[model samples]
Each structure stands twice: as C-alpha cells, then as structure tokens.
Target: MRTAGGVAGAVLVLAGGLLWDIPGLEPAGERMLGIFLAAIILWASEAIPLVATSMGILLAEVLLISSDGLFDVADDVGAVPAADYLAALASPVVVLFIGGFMIAAGATKFDVGRVLSSAILRPLGGRPRPTLLGVMAVTATLGMFMSNTATTATMFAIMLPAITALEDARSRTAMALAIPVAASVGGMMTPVGTPPNAIAIGILADQGIRVTFLDWVLLSLPVAVLLILVAWAFLAWRYLDTSSPLALDADARLDTSRPAVTFYAIAGLAILGWLTEPLHGLSSSTVSLAAVVALLALRVMDGEDVKRLDWPVLWLVAGGIALGRGVGDTGLDSWLIGAVPWGGIPAALVLLAVAAISWGVSNFVSSTAAANLLVPMSIGISISVANSTAEVAVVMALACSLGMCLPVSTPPNAIAHATGLVPTRDMVRIGLLVGGLGVLLLSVAAPLLWSWLGLT
Candidate 1:
C-alpha cells in the first residue's frame, strides 16, 4: 500500500509539474522539479530500490533537460551536456568510495578484524567496563576505514561469544548497544567512513572544493573521539558492572599466506597514499585504484571479489551527483534559494536547522539518501547566505550519520537490535542522548574548531 501510494504520488507530481506551469520556475526548472520531487518520494518511501531511483534521476535529466534532450526548449533556456549526467558514475568521489569498498572487502576476506580484535581486547584485562570500552574502541577505529555496517558486523562476530557469556542483562545490552553507537560516531572520522561523508565530499568537489583524506580526518576525528568517549561513559554508568570480569578469547593468529602478505602490503600503501596525497600529488582515487590493481594483479583478490563489492552504493552516490548537477544547470538551486526567505534568518541558525532536518529525516531513511536529498540544497543555501559551504556540507553529512534512534535508522543499529539483547526503549533512550549530543557538538563546537584550524 505504501509503495503504491508513493508511486502514484510521484507520477502525479511529475505530470502536474511538467504539464502545468509553476510561477517563477523556468521550463527546464519545472522539468527538473518533477524529477526531483519524484526522486524524493521514491527514495523516502523506498517505493523502488534506492539505486533505481538514482538511475532514473540520471536518465530523466538526460531526457528532460540536457542539451540533447528529447523535448524542444527555447534558445534562452540553458541545457547541460548529456555526458555531464552520465559522467556522475565515475566522479572522483565515487571513485574514492570504490577504493574504500575494495580495501574493506580485502580486510574482511583476510580476517583483519579478528586479528585486530584479539590483539586489542586481550590487554583490557576482561573487566566488564574495560572490555566494553575496548570493544567500542576497536569498533570505532575499524569504522574510520570500513563502512559502519561492516565494522559493526565484524565487531559483533568477534565479541558475541564473550557478550553472550555475561549473566547480567544490562551488561549484555550495554555491550550490544555500544557497537552501533561507536560505529555510527566513528564513521564521521573520514570521508570514506560513511556514504554521507562521501556524498558531501563529492558534492563539494563538484563545486571545485577539495577535501583531502587527511583534511577530513583533521576536521572530524576529534568530534568522533569525543562522542565515543561520552557514549561509553553513559553506557558504563547505566549498564556495566565493573566488578565483573568478561572472558574474551579471540583468535589472534595472523594469516601468513603469500596472498595475505600481499594484501597487507597493498592495504598499507593505499592508506599511506591517501594520507600523503599532498606530498605525492596523487588523488585519493588514483591511489585506491593502484591498490585495487595491485591486489588483483597479485591474486590477493580476484574478479569474484570485485563482483561482490558494493556497486549499489556507488550508483546511489552517482545519482546524487547527477541530481546536484541538474539542480545547478537548470537554475533549480537558485530557484530553491529564492523560494525561501533565508536572508532574514541568521546563518548560524540556518546551518543548525539544516543539521536538525538532516538528523530527523535520517532517523527514518538511509543516511546516504538523506544526504543525497539535503546536501545539494544545503550547498545552495550556504552559498546564498555567504556562509562556508564546506562547513555546512560537513555538518549536514555528519548529522545524517548521527541518527540512531531506532533499529531502522542505520544498518549497524539494525544489526544490534537483531541480537535481541537490546530492547527498543533502551535503544531510543541512549540513541537520543548520543544523537542529540552529536548534533549539539556539531552545531556549536565543531564550527569554532574548524575555524581555529582554518578548515572552513
């Protein structure tokens, strides 16, 4: 029923916008609006696959507004080249994420998570509080490089045995809750840490603003660490019993196979390249491709590995890039900026409002989708207000990742809820606290920090 309603509503809106005239909206803008509204409905309701909606956006733009579009338009109306829409798939940001996915896949294949967990957890002395902290720390650290979902799964798989052995229900709940919380927070540490970050960076790159890997890390890592510690303190106080010891027996054996050794070398070099981009004069995307090639050439990863990677994510991001381009080319962005009375509002409040809206919408939809829908508008609004575009973009992106109030909010949250150890009410309570804290910090502290560091 929801899917039917969504599809019906999208069709109606598209037809109405295309056929009927809208005041102050150009013909090209009207066409773009139809596609944009339809995309919102489809993405929000998930009436179809998110990637499907994204692909539709690209195709719709080409057919409706591109220079070579099917329909005729007045000479005064501007149209972007079809190639611009199609080229979104291989955008630098998309390429960067592709590399990130490859590295994550290789790490999972080689059982790097297990080895790291075993080494990191053994030193915490197995006490409940310390064990929980260690688990969260490992999860967050991995999340900085891996997707939050993958990081959560890896940590849970390694720690489930120890968590299950705990007699106290609160202890079990705390341990389970910590993984998603840490994963979500830690995902903000780097541009590749989550899809929203990548989407934001991609959008900014389109506007010719470059956010390097190290620059993103410098901008967000402090806040990530601070949020993780704050969450840990709350969980420990509320659920953990420090008097009890947790028995964690992890598999610490490192894979010594030739392929494993080769992967280690490639992974290390890839990370080094990403961090030293300025010195090497190589874009992160190029370095990632090099690592991917090395892995394949050395047989550490094969075609099958490549096939199993997360292509849908890349497609979804590409769709967003295309959407942003359409919005810009059709003057839809300017129309949107003019539609709102933004001049009367303070820039700081506008930034906070965007962050709040991003957080709220993300609680119901995927973070990537929320970022896809909002980042473009945020960029336009930021520019109109003479505010820092990068600051607004990064805040909205991080805010999207901060939504963890329910199982459906994020894949990591769903994974934790699936364990059945965490009740819905408990999740809401802690999630709201952590998520609210994140928004506050992002809105208040982060801007000052960014300015001090000259990041904005």
Candidate 2:
C-alpha cells in the first residue's frame, strides 16, 4: 500500500507540473502545484516518513522554483534564492518548538512529571470524581509545555495503577478517555504546544502578521480551559461515581539532586520568559534559544538529550512553512483563491467552513499535514474577504487540534486506545461530543470573544 501511494504521488507530481495546463498560472506556480499535490499524497498516506516529505519539499523548492534551479525557467516566474528554502529548517517557529522540546526532554530525564503529578493530585484527595478532574487538569497543564502524545503517555503511566484498581468498567473507560481529550485541548493553548499551532504561526509570520506567544495563550487558553471542563463534567457524570473512594499514590518524591535543581530553574525561567514576553521585550524564539543554551551549558541536558528531541515534528513544521511561502510566492494562492467564489460568501461562513474542513480532515490525516495544506488557503481567503488573518489562522490551528474521534486522529488518542481500556465505541461517542463542542466554540464563541476584546 505504501509503495502504491508513493508511485501515485510521483505520477501526480509529474502530471501537475508537466501536463496540467492551468490557465493564468505561472511556470513557478505549476511546479509549486506539483510539489503541493505530491506533498498531500505523501503526507496523507504516510508513504514516507513525515520528515522525509518535509525534506523533499525543501529540495523540490530549491531545485524547481528557486533561482538556483537546475533547469531553465521563464524570467516571469521570479524564483527566490535557495537560502529562502533552507532557512525553513531554522525558522523562528521551529526554534520555539526546539526550546519546548529541550524542556520536555529535561523534565522527562529528571522525572519532573511524576513529581508534579503526585504533588498536584495529593491536594485533590482520592475521591473518584475530583481525582479524575485533577488528573485531567495536570495532563492538560503538561500538554501545554510538552507534546500531547508525551503528556498523555506520562500521565497514563502514573495513573494506570489507580485506573486498573477501579471496580467499575465505566469508570476505567472514563479515566482512559479523559487524558487524551484534555491533552488534545491543552495543546491548543500555546504556540509550541503542537505542530499545527507552530505551522499556523510560521505561515502567518511569513505574511508579516506577528502572533506573539502571549497573544496565542490569550486567545486559546480560555477555549482550552472550557473544553477541559466540559469533557470532565461529561465524564464525571456519565462514568464516575462521586462517592467512591479511589486510592492513588501521590507520594512520589521530587528529585533534589544538583542536576535536577538546575533543570528546574532553567525550565521554570524559560516558561516565565515565554509568558512575560511583553515585559521582557524578547521574542519567544529568542527565549527558546536561551533555554536551549542554558540546558546544555549547565549540563542539565547533553547532546544525547538533544538527539532525543522530536526532530521529525520540527521538520514537518518547517515543510509547512516552506509550502506556505511557495504558495504565496508563486501565486498559487491567488489561483486557488480565484478558483472559489469566496467574495460572495459571508466572512463568518467562510471562517466556519474553513474551521469545519480543518476539523474534519484532521480526523482522517495528520493534523500537521492538514494544517500545512489548509493554512495558506485560509490566509488567502481571509485576505480576500478583508477578515483578520490571525483569527483565521488561530481557528484553523485549534480546529486541527480538536480532532480526536478515532485512534488515528491524534497520537495521544492512539496511545490511549492502545491501553486496551477504552473501547472503540466509547471513544467515538465521547470524541464526537468533545470535538463538536470545540468546533462550535471556535466557530461561534471564540470569534465573539476576539471581537469583544478588539483582538481582530
């Protein structure tokens, strides 16, 4: 199946570039179209590793559309320098995620999550309902800083013994469902929280629209908090018995070694830097780099820890940035905008449509891939309609994170499903409810909030 998909993707790339005669599209646009189509096929089908697809995009752009191209092309195509493509690997958005990854790596190495979870859960006591809420809150908080998949995995490892001790199957299923749902929602709260958010930020940055780290948290944190509460309420009422006394081990001791203390200081300062960007006047990317340097220089994290970071996710984000730039530079965005009669549609409907499409497609493919394919178009449509590009970007990014209907919808969901505690039906039922609520909030309530705050 993978081989067939790769061959098909190659054929589409050739056809799009050489055979398809799209009127009004420049030669550069044709080449970009080929790369875009091939990217969609390869990314959606997983015919190759996602990082490979990303690297391929960079290579294709440099070879086919850059001024450094091997083949001659019309002067009207206006190819950019090869350095433009190569720069995606080190883009600010990628750098921000790199900082987040370093923090996560150090935390994992020193067992910070275990200590934090234990500390937080101790206050909530061992009653089943409150315990579930505490578990979810801790998971979501961790998800904001770490990858959702990693957060879910870590929380489950801590909670598994308690979960298995539950006498009721419904209670076990609810506990299983809560971690991934909260993690997915929590990932939308910060720029470095997930790949789709990074993709959105990077694409918007290319358009000269700056979304600060604090600005992102302001816009998304409320929605994330509300969604977590909604999921918790549903799970608590439907599956948990409030009166039941659940026993959880909240006794894990914090590591107080010199290295662990140094890591804690560095990680805490990094987060403080991100949250106080306005006061400090340093960009989040710069703060991220500072954190990275601190970790290595202080010897809290080493070269081996750096190697353990999620390089593939960074590459995937870089590819999306390059693809967005290609779309705009080659005028493919204009062609696509013109292909649809978007001007006649209301701005609200357009936003809703894009959000809906993002949520739906993300359930079937990787959310990062879906964001890569859609964010450029969303930005173009928002521009055509004289709407806020930032709003559209945020909506699309959050929508991508909202998909959790199937095990394949997200890595966190897949990790939860693999535990054999959550039935498929149980997952689908709660997934739809939570995902639907998220979409409605993003499409309706979020816009009103943004407008009221004069953010748009």
Candidate 3:
C-alpha cells in the first residue's frame, strides 16, 4: 500500500511540474505546488521514510525549481542555488533539535526522569486528586525540556503500579489519560519541548522574525499552563473520584554517580543559557550545540547516545524549511497573498482557521509532520491577511500539540492507548473536549494576550 502511494505521489509531482501550468501562476509556482502536493502525500501517508521524503523534496527543488531548472526563466537570477536549498540540512533549527535530543538522551541514560517524578509527586501526598495532579505536573514539566513521547513513557512506568493498585477503575483510567495529555500540553511551554514550536520559530526566522527562547516562553508558557490546568480539571471531574485517596508509592533512588552529576550540571547550565538568551545574545542553536559538546567532553554521553538522537525528525524539519524557501523563491507566497481572499477576513479568524486545520490534521498524522505542513502555509496566509506571523506561528504550534484524539494522533496518545486502560471512545470524547478548550483558549488568548506581550 505504501509503495503504491509513493509511486502515485511521485508521478503526480513529476507530471504536474512537467505538464500542468495554472493560469496567472508562474512556472516556478506551479511546479512548487506540485512538489508541495507530493510532499503532503508522502508525509501524510508515510509512504516512504520521512527522511527519504525530505531528501526527495530537496532533490525535487533542485531539479524542478532551483537555478537553471525546468521552471527557470529569464529574470530569475534570484533563484535559490541548489547549495543554498540543501543548506537547510544543517540549519540552526536542525541543530536546535540535535541539542535537545542530546539532553533528553542524557536524562534518560541517568534515570533523571524517575528521580524527577518521585521528587515532584512526593509533595502531593497519596490522595487521589493530588496524586493525579502531581503526576500530570511532573510529566508536563519533563515534557517542557524533553520529548513528550519520552516523558509520557517514563511517567507511565512510574505511575502504572500506583494506578493498578487503585481502589477504583475510574481513578486508574483518569491517571492513565492524564499522562499523555499532560505530556503533550507540557511540550507547549518551550521551543525545544516540541517539534512544532521549533518548526514555527525556524520558519519565522526566514521572514526576519527573531523569536528568542525567552520570547517563545513568554508568548506560549501562559497558554501551556492554562491548558495543563484545564486538562487536569477535566480529567479529575470526568474520570476520577476526587474524594478517594490513592496509595501510590513515591519512592525513587536518585543516581549520584559522577556521570549523572555531570549530566545534571551541564543540563542545568544549558537551560539557564536558554532562559537568558537575551542576556548573553548567543543564539539558541549555538547554546544547544554547546551543551551537546559539554555532554561529550564531560563524558556524560558517548557515541551510543549520539547515535540515538532523532535524526529523522531533524530531516523532516529541514525539508519543511526547504519547502518554505521554495515557496518564496517561486513567488508563490507573493502570488498567494494576491490570490487568497483576505481583503475582508478578520485576522483572528485567519488564526482560528489555521488552528482548526492543524488540530484536524494532527489527529491523523504526527504532530511534527502536521507542523511541517501547516507552519509554512500559515506564514503565507498571514502574509495574505496582514496578520502577525508570530501570532499565527504560535497558534499553529500550540494547536499541533493538541493532537490527543486518537492512538495515532501523537506518540504519547499511542502510549496511553497501548496500556489498554483508555478506550478509543473515551479518548475521543475527552480529547474533543480538551481540543475544543484549546481552540477556545487560542481564540481568546492569542489575539488579546499576545498583543499585550508585543507579539502582534
């Protein structure tokens, strides 16, 4: 099935670029659209390896739209050279994820997650409601700096025993549901917390919009906090019996070995650097890569850890960046600004529409992939509507984090479903509610709150 999809997608792209030409659209724009469609099919369907699809997109751009390509025309001196287009493979955004993966790898290797989980949950006592909240809080906190999928998996390992020993099945279910949802929402708090956020920042950087690590946290932390709170309340009220007490064991042995201590110290310094990026004026990517170096120099992580980094995701992001640039090079973004009906549409509605598209698509595919597809489109649409690209980027990034409706919506969601404690219907019913609340929060919070923060 995937083979068929790949063949069809490739055929469509090659045919559209070589044969079809839309009226009022430049040859480059038409070809880019074709490549864009092919990427959509390849990515959405997972018809091939995502990294291969990304490489395919790069090859397509070089062959179809780069300088002296099939779509090249006179007055196209400004065409992106194949080298410039391929440079996305080493983009700062890609480096950012590289650093993030190193940090996560270190944390996982030293069992930092277990220690953090115990430390946070220890304060909430053994009561059912507090226990639930504590677990969610810890999971979310971990997610703010690591992969939500990893955070969810780690928390599940720690919390499952407590959940299984619960007096009531409803309490077990509530705790189960909270792990993934909290992790997903928690990732919204920071740029390195999730791919969507990183992708958003990377795309915006192409437009000369420099959003610092602190800038992103200032714009998004409030929304993440609010979503976590709402998710907690919803899970408690609907799935858990708050009146009962949960007898959870909150014991964890913190590893205090030399390598572990070094890891923590380096991780702490890295985070401090990220939070104070404006103070030092070092780019987040630089700081992140520095951390990776420190991790290796200090012997906190070895080649095995390096090999375990999420390279495929980095490739996906590189492809997305290349595609966005291609759209700009081909004059599609400018043409889109004129072609789309943005004259009468309000800016807030544009944001909401992008959020809806992101939310809908993420339910079926990886949120990272969803972000890769939608973030670029949102930037183009923002140009059309004269809206704040920063605001649109933040909205779409957060919306991608709302992929909790199904087992496939996100890795964390899949983790929850694999436990057999959460039914598909329950996840859908509550996921819809959580997702609706997310939309509502963005609808009200993004315009008003982001403006107050100068993001608009």
Model 2, residue pairs in steric clash: none
Per-candidate TM equals: 0.98, 0.97, 0.96
Task: Write out the backbone clash pairs for model 1.
Answer: none
- For 1-456, candidate 3 gives per-residue lDDT tens digits of 777967697777767766787776777777887888887888788878777888888998888888855555555523767887888899898898888889988888888888887887787777777777888888988898888988999888888877888777788889999999889988998888988898888888888999988888888778778777887888888889777677666687888899998888999999999899999999999999999999998888989888888888788888888887887777766666677687578877777787888898989988888887778776677777787878887888889888789988999988999998998888897689778778777866667988886766
lDDT of 2 by residue, 1-456 (tens): 886868587667856685677899988888888888888888788887888988989999888888888656557364788899889999999999999999988888888788888998898888888888988988988899999989999999999988888888888899999999988888999998899999998998988888889889989988889989989999998888666666888899989999999999988999999999989899999999999998899888899999999899999999999998888888889888888888899988887888889999899898899898888786788878888988988899899998889999899989989999998888888888887888888888999999998776
Model 3 alpha-carbon miss at residue 406, Å:
1.0
The segments of candidate 2 whose C-alpha lies over 4 angstroms from its true place after superposition are: none
Worst lDDT run of 10 residues, candidate 3, spans: 69-78
Per-residue lDDT for 303-385 in model 1, tens only? 99999988998899899888888887777888888988888888778877888899999999999899888888867898778
Q: In candidate 3, residue 17 scores what lDDT?
A: 67
Query: Candidate 2's C-alpha lDDT?
Result: 0.88
